[model samples]
Target: MNRTTPSTHPSSDKGHSVVAAPVTAHPLAELIAHEIRERGGWMGFERFMELALYAPGLGYYSGGRRVLGQRPQDGSDFVTAPELTPLFGEVLARQVLQALDATGTDEVWEFGAGTGALAEQLLGELGDRIQRYVIVDLSGSLRDRQHQRLLKAHPSLVHKVIWADSLPEAMSGVIVGNEVLDAMPVHLLSWDGARWQERGVALAPQGDTPHPTFAWADRPAPEGVRPPTEHPDSAYPPGTVTETHGQAEAFVATLAQRMVRGAAFFLDYGFPEAEYHLPQRHGGTLMCHHAHTADADPLAMVGDKDITAHVNFTGIALAGQEAGWEVLGYCSQGRFLTNCGLGEALARTGQASNAADIQSRVALQMLVAEHEMGELFKVIGFVKGPWFEAIGFAHGDRTHTL
Candidate 1:
């Protein structure tokens, strides 16, 4: 990606230590500020977020693959499940293999293949069983890193890996996305105790503030101001801020259309429809990750960190269903992994004392623990053409919850 400009910021954000942001003003901020000026001095938060996180080479995700890792020393904002342990992918492979066997396809399409860690784990474990591994990414920035990783780590099977900037006319295989949907940009809606408005960002004058700022500004929700229909009762109190899942829902709608004969699975931390739109959650889920620290301010750093929002499984399920795809199942990561045979995998490791083995065990435990990724992270499966009882949902399918 040919980014607009470089970014420069301080090493700390709001008194908290973080990955040192550029000392000088980042070029991307200048470009975005100019963009805001051109757009009548205001840009919707969604558009701002999209540009900040996916603006070619300038976005947080479009530059490097090392941002996804398990340790703080990895120079990453946060660690995903795949970065935690090989067992994460191994157990997930069991679920994918079953889906492939059921659908009678040998291909695996992965979205947002971070660091190619999960890809390596899947390819290594699946072996000759998987004929092709297609990585579909919008940024295309990780191609070189993924290619080198595959070539060096699995020389013989490296030929099976391919990268695509766009989706094929139709797909017929197992599709997987881990911690992917949460990163999709979300629309922020605010209730000001009286009316609804859309929250957005506007550029601050060149010398108005430090760290090159984009201040929060609100306007009538574009077309006929109104809150989302997810909650028609208007039960939310004043001063409430919530998010609408248009991007995530739209992505699923498009995926359902392109996928002609296969099942897709997404793993992320989210909640069902009823729980998601709770009035108690006054603040929206918009968040930023920097050096393992979570923060709510996006104005401080332009392109120096990761920004994300929680997934609305309800919106995802509705999109898939509306597009005529079957909602196979939805369950916790722990239950899903257990149903997919995590115990068998752990037993095979045999209480090894080696560092690698010990790390794998710890990761496995974290993946299934009560208060860890186990309960918060969820797995949702969708199918288009052929269908069979997805084994991962056999234990406690929560299709009804969605």
Candidate 2:
């Protein structure tokens, strides 16, 4: 959502910061604090993040907040490609069509279908070709919003859409997950040249305020635990902070395992392993977003903001490969979208000076510009059945990079 990379700074008490001392207790803060106490005043950053983003009825996504939109004026936290323009899905649908035909499947599964904007675009473009459109999302509130949007937009085709609470034992479809992996909980790790530690969350002592303030707390990581990097500990400068995407990797492995026949395409902003863990990237990619603005402090606003980390494409590819899936390709979003005809679609808008056409053109540029989402956002495709040359990766395929 919010695409800002903020550096982590050292604090007085070890490397942790006393993030905030709230004037009043946030309900979610209290809940997390109680859990910290229950767990002996410490909680792994992964669990803390899971609670902060997905705890039932209190976390960010499950808290009934309007998260995705074009701007802050709509009371939305951040914007996604689908929200930026319908052309994203329209172009992606071309790739999905190829995957569906190659795998001989008529179903489509979308994880974390934010606002259902992409779903609407795909469903409209693909039409009767798709027998079913299954959405697997954790946010009940967002699911309700998606239902209403889809119903109003495609009244006759609404019945083809289904909401699934969880993945079944077996499924066949072209799966899509846009901006999903980055949101999964990641384990925070900090290296101090000599040793590495697992950074977690601890409640700061309660002062005059009734609520608890959160702070960073580092404990010796398990003997073998470390960042998935080829570099040695000596290569990392002291106080270098980073993240390991166990959950995200496992999620991909699970998807690879469950799909009987189909392909999956995930689009997100991230780097390959080598770039992700470069010595200069010591600050790590963990970030928080609220009202379309971004910050590095996730412990401050609690459930009021969205927390995320950059996806490790190398790790994702390995996970899927190890779990019986073949990598179709990986490349920049710009290249993939262009291969799928995004540039051609933009050209169709012509020289019309209408506001809608102008806006569409601008959005298309943002999607493919190197300084914008084009270079930063990447698409990775996986297939469980026979591999075919996907149109999205017809050119500039970077599968070897991963």
Candidate 3:
């Protein structure tokens, strides 16, 4: 694979910027081009995303990239909550402990356990209260990293840690997924004045470039293919682009079916269906992150960056509820963490006079402050057997909104 510095170019189509660079021969690019050709020169964006992120050994997550870190200087793409500070996981552990006790389950299932930082923190805090810690991650490289980190962090309990590529046939545990649903592939739907179309990827015409260049191509959407909006299509102005979370919703439904009795929580940045498909919000939430920078062009850097879309919590709740899982609660991450005792934990850290303490204080603030991750990020919980008031959503439960 050839590596070259990327330069940003303002895109005229949408307000989002794109990484404009010379087309270089990359293995993943070639593979995708071949697939597009085999599929008659057009491939759905969802399939492209699936291959770009989770296709065996060539995808981004599985391609041995250092994806999670505090800074771009570490050759990482983005920073997650657990990576931001240990306080995040510590505060979340309270809810997990409550769920374990409430559900009478000893196992903890974590999806997309990046760097295993949260797992390590949870394992350390929960101690022997956890019988089995199962991690379901598609990235082999990340699994290796998680294994090493967990082994060193919790030597005695490492034996109880299990790594699986997919969910088991039947299981009972408290499931946790941080920034996981947003990564799942989503179908892109663009609205025109007349009708809705499915946005896809197609090979650009041959030019002086050395490798194949991909471009957006739209086709008429199938019948009933439109955003889940209460308002009529005419309400949205032309050029409105959005995503449908089929894969993510299916994931929740499947998990609800598999789990005999347990609770699950997902933390991510998203909004309800009404807010998601708003008229003024023309550009969708589809974004790409690389080296701590964000861009809108997923076609530019095939397997080098992370592609994600905002979660539609309303749809997620319906899916789970339809599949026999009761909605425990839904609220902002800031409120949930605060309700789960984040403020108390901060107090225990003492006055922020020392540099280390100050840094901890800042990280904690970012996790809860409305201007930062607190407001935009949300937490949704689900229970299979019986409904118990989750501590995280005790005070600020927004399940009514969902």
Candidate 4:
């Protein structure tokens, strides 16, 4: 396991910046290009996302680069909860403890333990009381690093740690995946004002070299689309483009099928079914991350960049119900935190710290406020059995909040 940051290999010089690092042919980039060519040069954005996120060894996550690398070029690409504050984990611990006690299990399984920050924080909060802690992720190097970090942070809890390649078979415990589902492959569907078509990527021949371009595939309008765009409301434009997620359904279905007699909590950015289908969001929510900047060009950097789509919470809830799990609760990140006593937590910390700790309070507010990641990100939980009495689900109208 290496802590060194993986290099982003630029695939083409066109549309690249002088500030952009020189092009290096990462194996994943070549494979993606070849795959596109083999597929007659036109593949859906979903296919592109599948390749970017899960394509064997060459994809963003599969290719050994930091998929959570959200920071910037000098460092990694991204910073999540564990990266921002330890309090995030403490609050999560409080929530997880509620779920664990309800489920009557002491197991904790985490997916994509980015930098092991969440794991370290949760373990620190749970202490020796937690019976088992497991991480299901691909980066073996990251798993080793996580092991070392956890051991150093809580040597007493080291014996309880477990690492696996996938979710345990019919395990009874609390499962936590933060900012995970957004990375799942998303099929981009657009209403051309006449018919529904899926956005596909293809190889565009540029002299001796090739570049990727967006093309359309004939498909039915996603289930959420409305035939007549007649909004008797404000802020919505007629003839606007809209996007809905089909991939999120598949992922949630998979989770629902596997999760039996336990609780599953997923935290990501998205809206409810009604809000998700609003006419204002016509441009679609598909975006790519290149050198920390958001770009629409999925083919710009190949495997070196991050491509993500917003999760559809409505779809997740529907899929979870279909998969035989009970939808325990749903809420915006703000309401979920508030229901989880975020305000009280902040007040308690405020009482403990001096003026210097003001920044921490501000940051906490940012996480749960209406304007920040609070509204954009949401928390949804599914329980297989009688795991009730949690803060977020029992009290808040997550639907109205959205």
- As a whole number from 0 to 100, the lDDT of residue 27 in candidate 2 is 92
Model 2 clash pairs are none
> lDDT per model, in order?
0.78, 0.89, 0.86, 0.67
| lDDT by residue (tens digit), candidate 1, 21-118 | 23337667877877888999888878888988888777888755356555568676777777778898989998898898888888999998877888
Question: Model 3, stretches more than 4 Å misplaced?
Answer: 1-22
Superior by TM-score: candidate 2 or candidate 3? 2
Which candidate achieves the best TM-score against the true structure?
A: 2
Candidate 3 local Cα displacement, residue 65, angstroms: 0.7
Score every model by TM-score: 0.90, 0.97, 0.94, 0.83
C-alpha positional error of residue 46 in candidate 3 after TM-score superposition, expressed in Å = 0.5
List clashing residue pairs in candidate 4. 41-202, 69-77, 69-78, 70-77, 70-78, 71-77, 71-78, 241-282
Question: Could you tell me the lDDT of residue 219 within candidate 4?
Answer: 46
lDDT of 2 by residue, 102-139 (tens): 99999999999999999999999999999999999999
- For residue 169, give model 4's deviation from the true position in Å: 3.4
Candidates 1 and 3 compared by TM-score, better number: 3
Candidate 1 regions with alpha-carbon error over 4 angstroms:
1-24, 205-211, 222-234
- Put the candidates in TM-score order, highest first: 2, 3, 1, 4
C-alpha-based local distance difference test score of model 4: 0.67
TM-score of 1: 0.90
